[model samples]
Target: MAEPAGGPPRAGLVSVVIPARNAEATIAVQLDALYRQTYPGPWEAVVVDNGSSDGTRAVLRSWQRRMPQLRPVSAPEASGANHARNIGCRLASGELVLCCDADDIVAPGWMAAMVETLRTSPAAGGALERRSLNGTVALAARPPKESDSLLDTFGFLPYPAGANCGFHKELWRRLGGFDESYRYGSDDVEFFWRAQLAGYELGFSPHAVVHYRLRDGPLAIARQLYCYGRSHPRLYRDFRAYGMPRSRIGEAVRAWWRLLVHAGDLAATPERRSAWLAGLALRAGRVAGSVRHRRPYL
Candidate 1:
């Protein structure tokens, strides 16, 4: 497929959509990082204020004076992040669409690398460098050295971090945007699976990097994992549409055992405890979700 022609040549405008919800402290840094991007093509940043009660709106408005390419939009329904993202995307003037979270810092050259990859490849995710709030790099969830697919969303070395992924605007329209019903998580996972099922190859970029802030503490991480786990039943049901078997019982049992052993380990540091509980929460959530969706997903 050819790069969709826009008023801008070379690569056309790359629209970056950011979904913000009470992210007053972090949104400005993300916008600043976008301002620093060396991507020469025409690009725009659309921030969808997803019912933030903080000063997120004022901060975005303030940044507009500095980054004229930035556009502020609203997703006031208190729906889902996907809804906010779709809203921002519809407001885009570019053919290539990028999605980033409100709390990430894009590396220099991030935009150019992702846009170039999507220009030549089907779908692409920029590399991610995760850090704690104190700026320490996370030991896990590191970006892969090669490209990945929706199949890799679990039990694999590579998967697209939603904060660092993008694809063609046409592709988004064809997929009908993300499943807004997925309020907790896995909306991106479903989209990736749908796109790959539609035959679009998912690509990865090492040079296109973003610094992500990991969840702050134990409860935070555990809650995040719980939501992810609860989303699995629906995720698996969606996968069945593409020919996966109905039963994932055996695989789920093994995973449950693994989490049990992990939680029983002696080392009890906050981070380690968090991981252990998170694993358990995920298993519990998957089981609950599986029951709710009437699929033996767990």
Candidate 2:
């Protein structure tokens, strides 16, 4: 359980993978956090810019001069986050891979914690928590439980937010990286499940934290919920089609329902009733996905 040797002494060389599209506004903040890390190990940030028409490229260029550790790679194909991440992983030279979104801020000691945990544990990966804009923090939902057997963990795998997870380079390659067929969310879930099924252990590290910035407006929140609802059935269908267990469908449905009921919690004012309405719209999308995929729920 000693720290993995023959790499950078303190922090190790962690390739921080960032997949971004039109993230001109927040990418700088994320990079700033990376540059300021208190963990003084050799590391690099590989940002894959996926067909951003905005000034995202320019912003990255601006930072490249200021932050030598930042490297921007272009992925103009629009293949999605998974595609971009794969590109970054291939280009990365570090022994460890840490994934993050373009819109998140990592804590100062984030990389240090992930390196220490992965080095000491038998886990193929480590999970971290995220703090939402409202200052509410929640564990990244993956692996179902701390004591889950490796295979069962695959059955109910919860993913560390792509923004807050870390894994060894070789293990990532063995799992074949994220499946690009899923152009958005759930790719993380699918990849993690496959890794667990293949006998790789996954664990959690509370210190590797990030602040997730939710969209500022209620309408944006509603849109995000709607997308989640629409993606649920697709996730389940893919899960079953690939021969993984079909256990989480009911949980997905409940999540949709909970979102509908708690839409008010995200709204800032009574005038923002549209957010709740939007939540209903998202719920309908989830139902449609369920029916189209014919995924079973009890």
Candidate 3:
């Protein structure tokens, strides 16, 4: 049986912040999922349109009628997603904030699970790994579609998909929200690392799930990888002293080795090949970024 409204939402109200950039094609799906959350409490969705030239704003405005809780804001001069997120956070009235993506679809009960995690944790600040308030993060799976139940997220790019994660609004303010200077990825990573150093404890919610969209097409993957690679150096620059590893230094060589070993096997399937090519592009971008930034990143 489902826990009543008295279950794990002891935490204060939740504010879902979504940063959108020309996402008219899919924002409605996300909004629909948000509207269906079962947590019967005060909650709001904040959407920040970051210089979108399309009908994105129109779509958002239309949704506002149905979801009065959905607040729409614009960052016409902003340059990155993080910037938009920061803006949305500032406009938020809820003490608890959830950073959701404009394209992904969150599962039902996700909000409650996240709230439970924070409300029941032993500390004031922490992250939930899976979807249960008291769930063991050590046994959680990898980021959305990366892998199936990877045990520990220590090695992979696992630190709670920013799109599906939530936190106390005060913490967001204290940490200054996400770094808006970045034009690419890793902004979430940077914030998460800094938060951990600031003594935030992480919780796991096995039920708080979001169906994340993966970059797949050749050009799409390449662009995503390039941006991700380019942004990585910034993360290191900001958090190396806080223990962000330097393993990225040999990323290219390792990537090549993996390619050599799995070339034939990967060719056996179109999906595998597509992913393999994306990995190669990412490695290339990583190497280029290291040289460009004069950092031992790739």
Q: Could you estimate the TM-score for every candidate? A: 0.86, 0.77, 0.81
Tally clashes: model 2.
4
Please identify model 1 stretches exceeding 4 Å from their true place: 1-11, 132-151, 155-159, 245-251, 258-267
TM-score, candidate number 2? 0.77
> Highest lDDT: which candidate?
1
lDDT of 1 by residue, 87-195 (tens): 8777778889988899879889999889888878767887666543432212222222333232255542234767889988888888898878988878778777788
Per-residue lDDT of candidate 3, residues 1-298 (tens digit): 1111212222457788898988898899989989999998889888888888888988988998899888888778867878888888887877778887897778888888778876854212122333222112111111222323212322532355567677777788888888887668776776766677777765656677776665435456557777777766656666567666775436557778997887784556555665566667666776676777777676
The prediction achieving the highest TM-score against the true structure is 1
How do the residues 1-298 of candidate 2 rate in per-residue lDDT, one tens digit apiece? 0111223312357788899899998899999988988877788888999889899989988998999888889888667888988888877778788888898788788888877877854343333333344321111111123321222333456556566777877777887878887664566677777776788778777777677665544456556656556666777676666665654657767867776677765455433454454557566667766776686421
Order the candidate numbers by TM-score, best to worst.
1, 3, 2
| lDDT agreement with native, every candidate | 0.75, 0.68, 0.68
User: What residue runs in model 3 are displaced by over 4 Å at the alpha carbon?
Assistant: 1-11, 121-158, 248-252, 260-269
Q: What TM-score quantifies how close candidate 3 is to the native fold?
A: 0.81
Please give the range of 10 consecutive residues that has the lowest summed lDDT in model 1. 1-10
| Pairs with backbone N, CA or C atoms under 3 Å apart (clashes), candidate 1 | none
Which whole-number lDDT from 0 to 100 does residue 24 have in model 3? 99
